[model samples]
Target: MFACQVEVVVLTCEPLTMGEERYYAAEIVLKSDFVNGRVGLQVSLEDLDEWERCLDALEAEAGAEWPTGGRSAWLAVVPEDPVEVTVHDSPSTQIAVRMPIDVASDWLEENRLRLDRVQKAVATVS
Candidate 1:
């Protein structure tokens, strides 16, 4: 059993197109700071399929009994393995975390009422 508490200050959700396929994914910026900036984690392109699969499961259930139910379902979709975290331009500076999806879902649920920060960052970055 492993978990790490991380503060997601902003998320960059964007559409990725590859030939005939399009994926909607997000890059989360952690509040964990470095000398110059904060550490970031990108939801890998392959994981976009996982996100869609989780969404499909939600639809198949015909909606959740409560909002958090939906979030937990999504969290449960994460593979039970350590996810790679890397710092750009620093190939040797790599790290990993377990239960990333559960952590992210928990954060989202906690801050469900304050999505304006994420939305604003997405708009500005896009």
Candidate 2:
């Protein structure tokens, strides 16, 4: 069976000011039989929130790309028939891998749950 897993590890976070804004340092990990890529980048809460929205509203022609502008190592999900997941390294590395996975019908729900866990984890950071 093919497998694709994405994980976001919030290594540390700092308050941007005396407000709710935070500077989050996170590592995005994508793993499968064909790819094992990790990208470390700075993210805002909006980035994570937007990711959730993307997954929720995913469609064949409307795929999702994290970190939006390829500013760093990024991942994109192309929701074709089998759901293609692509992992790309920053321009310096220039390495990319794409693989199709046979996911359950509730894959989006599962991913949303995983992201929710990450969100909760980030909330506890000091």
Candidate 3:
């Protein structure tokens, strides 16, 4: 298959309640050289699950704290050139949002549930 590098800049999940519909919506800013510079992608519960699967693989292959080459996020994919992706997505039915799904998931798991989120709720303005 194609070899590419993947990393996640940010991952966030917010509890949403709209009438009877309630769910946790998420946003993931997956950073990769293969696709755009910083691809801000959205994620749902299913997406988060998908990402966790990738994270599991990374943990199994590498340690929990994977080397980031002194970078903030871990290296999601191992190798690839962005140019090739551009070529493959050209012409009819041609478009690519080259986000490494697994990497985003790993980022989510790594950054999910923090201590600071337990702080007091925001106060309403008078």
Candidate 4:
């Protein structure tokens, strides 16, 4: 089993469509010990329906599809083995998603360009 750790830094809801609706956007970070790399994933949606649509887009973009048709307030990439997600009821909800290294690697490869751009922008601002 490939060991990995995943964390979500931010999940923000913004008004869209002339303030008629709200969208959810999140920033996810994955780190692996098996591989010397890290990945940051981001997604945005205009509403629950739009979130589901965005998730579909994500699957297609990643080239690994899932057969689920619903809107999820939050989702995480987890390992094939048994895993658990703990959510802390705090001001900023904290969730922990555990996945295998291989899965993490695949996600990183799929989002390399976007992740690299985010990292570069962060570096420039720092």
User: Model 3 — TM-score against the truth?
Assistant: 0.32
In candidate 2, position 97 carries an lDDT of 69
- Among all candidates shown, the one with the greatest lDDT: 2
The better-scoring model by TM-score among 1 and 2 is: 2
Predicted candidate 4: what Cα RMSD to the true structure? 15.2
Compared with the true structure, what per-residue lDDT tens digits does model 4 show for residues 1-126? 122354322222222232543322333333444223222222333233343443455445432221123333234333233322221222233433434333354543444444445445444533
Give me candidate 1's TM-score against the actual structure.
Answer: 0.30
Q: How far is 6's C-alpha from truth in model 3 (Å)? A: 13
The lDDT of each candidate is: 0.35, 0.65, 0.34, 0.34
Measured by TM-score, the strongest candidate is 2
Residue pairs in collision within model 2: none
Question: Lowest-scoring 10 consecutive residues by lDDT in candidate 4?
Answer: 82-91
- Residue-level lDDT of model 3, residues 49-110, one tens digit each, is 44445446544553232222222222234222221221112232333343433333333343
Model 1: residues >4 Å from true position, as ranges? 1-6, 33-93, 97-126
* Residue 103 lDDT in candidate 4: 37
Root-mean-square deviation of each candidate, in angstroms? 10.8, 4.9, 11.5, 15.2
Which has the better TM-score: candidate 2, or candidate 4?
2
Model 1 lDDT per residue over 28-48, tens place:
344443322333333434443
Q: State in Å the error of residue 30, model 4.
A: 0.4
